[model samples]
Target: MEYFTELFFSGLTRGSIYALIALGYTMVYGIIGLINFAHGEIYMIGAFTSFVVATVLSIYGFPLLSIVLLAGLAAAVWSASYGYTVEKIAYRPLRHAPRLSALISAIGMSIFLQNYVLLAQSSEFQPFPELIPDFDFMEPFAHVVGSSDLVILLTTALVMVGLTMLIKFSRIGKAMRATSQDRTMAMLVGIDVNKVISVTFIIGSALAAIGGMLIASHIGQINFFIGFIAGIKAFTAAVLGGIGSIPGAVLGGFVLGLTESFATGYVSSDYEDVFAFTLLVLILIFKPAGLLGREAAEKV
Candidate 1:
């Protein structure tokens, strides 16, 4: 029971990261049907940005919490800017082209961003500050929450709540929903489709950026390739949660996170990724749409 309990919380923390990144995948897909392969790269950029900020702040003798906060802010800004550029440069021009062309463009953009970062930051891992506290709250029960886990969980919760509010009550939120439902109709209704799309990218990127920052803080270092596997996992979570559903993404992320953690604990660590991908395949074959996903009827 104790082992299960530990695994559950651990999974939840990981799931939170996946959920944040999955939001970007689901949102962009909902609004424009683009995969935004470069989305992962944006996450990598955010982690690096936060790392740099934290390092600079540490040099100036900032408090630990302050350093993490400033790092998050820097990450969010960098992610938002990167997302805007990706949409503007890679996706916007291909809006009228064949869908395949847009997908290819996304791939190309992803490669370009990866190489750009490699050139800029190198392939070596850059260390992050020790902002996370090391105390375990449930030491008595042999249950413990590492500082990194706590930060990841808290950040994920705050971001999720804020996103719910943003989508539920805000003006841009409504516009986004309208655009997602029907782009042409949204344009006819004077919703400024392009602006909504841009905003969607910004929001998605910002969330992913925060996720990246938390991940870096938790892991204590990051590299240009950090986003690759994490992005894949998050995308899988999005698909598992019913691609365009916000809550679905969150649920899927949690599920996937727990599954991975449990696999690592029960099975060999080497088999962890294999188990995850195998589960993804099984879900696709059996559930098709996803755990929370519903099938859309064909329009007559």
Candidate 2:
């Protein structure tokens, strides 16, 4: 039972991280119908940005909390800029093009970004310092909630809650919903569809950036190739929960994370990736559009 408890908590922590990143994927796809395959690279870039910021601040004798905050700020800025540029350059030009063409462009952009990171940061893994200090909890059950785990879960939950409120009440959020429902109608209603898309990208990228930082901190290292599988997993979570549903993404992330963790714990760590992928397939077969996803009815 203790071992099961450990796995459950561990899975929740990982799921929280996955959910954070998955939010970005669902948000972008909901708004534009573009997959943004390069989003994972944005995650990678954020982690690297955090790493660099931490290195620089360490020289100045800054505390761990201060350094992490600084890193998050830097990562957010860099990811926002990158997302803006990507939408403007790669996606905007294809806005009116066929879906296949836009998808091809996204793939090309993803490849370009991957190579860019490889050239800039190298392919090797770089170790990172632990941002949160470790301490024993007074309660015996506290072992289930390690410092890093607490941070991941709390940060993700807070961010998710804030995001839900933003989408529910903010002016831009209304515009986004308008655009998602019908771009032409949104434009007629005096909303700048392009601006809405841009804002969506910025928000999604920032979320992914935070996820990257948390993941790197959790694992104790960052690498150029780290985004590949993580991105796929996040995308899967988004799909599992209902790609266009914000709350769905969060639910799916936790589900996938918990499942993967327990599967690895009991089934076999070596086949963890396979198990995750298999689960995705199984979910898709039964739910089609996803657990929370609504099936679109064809118009006559």
Candidate 3:
């Protein structure tokens, strides 16, 4: 039972991270119908930004709490800027062009960011400071779940709730929904579709930034290539849950995380990727639209 509990929490933590990044992918796709492949690179940038800020603050003898807060803020702001810029430069021009053009541009941007980071920063992994302190209250369950895991789970829950509220009640949320339904119609109805798309990218990038910071802190090290694998998994999670559905993305993330966790625990860790991808394939075969995804008819 203790072992089971440990694996469960581990899976939950991993899922939370995946969900955060996946939200970025899903939101971009929902609004623009274009997959922002560069999103993973945005996440990588966030982790790097947080690492730099936290390291600098630590050197100056700032309090741990202050370091964490400032680092997270910096990561979000910088990542959002990158996301917005990517939208304008790489995607906006191809908005009315063939979907392939936008996809190619996204891929090119991802590659560019990865190589840029590698050249700017060393290719080796850098140690990430332990920003999240172990809480005294969590001592009892420390064996089953670490403080970082607890923090990740709680933080993800809060983020999800806050996101839900924003999309449901806020004016921008309404605009986002309108834009997603039909960009042309949204513009005709006096909604600023471009602004809505930009805002969606910003929110999604911010969320990814948070995930990047938390995961980097949890893992204790980061490299330029970390984003590639994480991004692929998150993208898989989004597709697994229904690419355009917010709730589905969350659900898919948790499910994928648990599957990977249990597979690693009961089986060999070497086959983890195999199992994860196999599950995705099986799910797609049975339900093409996704677990919570509804099929939509194309207008001719």
Count clashes in each candidate, considering only residues at least 3 apart in sequence or on different chains: 0, 0, 0
- At residue 63, give the lDDT of candidate 1: 88
Better of 2 and 3 by lDDT: 3
TM-score of each: 0.95, 0.96, 0.98
Clashes of 1: 0
Q: For candidate 1, which ten residues in a row score worst on lDDT?
A: 135-144
> Candidate 1 on 1-300: residue-level lDDT in tens?
878888888899999999999999999998898888888888988988888888899999998888878888989998899999999989999998988999999889888988898999888988877767665664454345566787788888888899899898999999999998899999998999999999999999999999998888788889889888889999999998888889989998998998899999999779888888788888889988887777766789
Question: Best to worst by TM-score, what's the order?
Answer: 3, 2, 1
Compose the digit string of candidate 2's lDDT tens values, residues 175-228. 998898888999998999999999999998898898899889888998788888
Runs in model 1 with CA error above 4 Å? Answer: 135-143
Against the reference, the lDDT scores of all candidates come to 0.88, 0.87, 0.94
| TM-score head-to-head 1 vs 3, winner | 3
Q: How accurate is candidate 1 locally (lDDT)?
A: 0.88
lDDT at 96 for candidate 2? 91
lDDT of 3 by residue, 80-146 (tens): 9999999999999898999999999999999999999999998999999999999999999998999
Which pairs of residues clash in candidate 1, taking residues 3 or more apart in a chain or in different chains?
none
- Which residue pairs show collisions in model 3? none
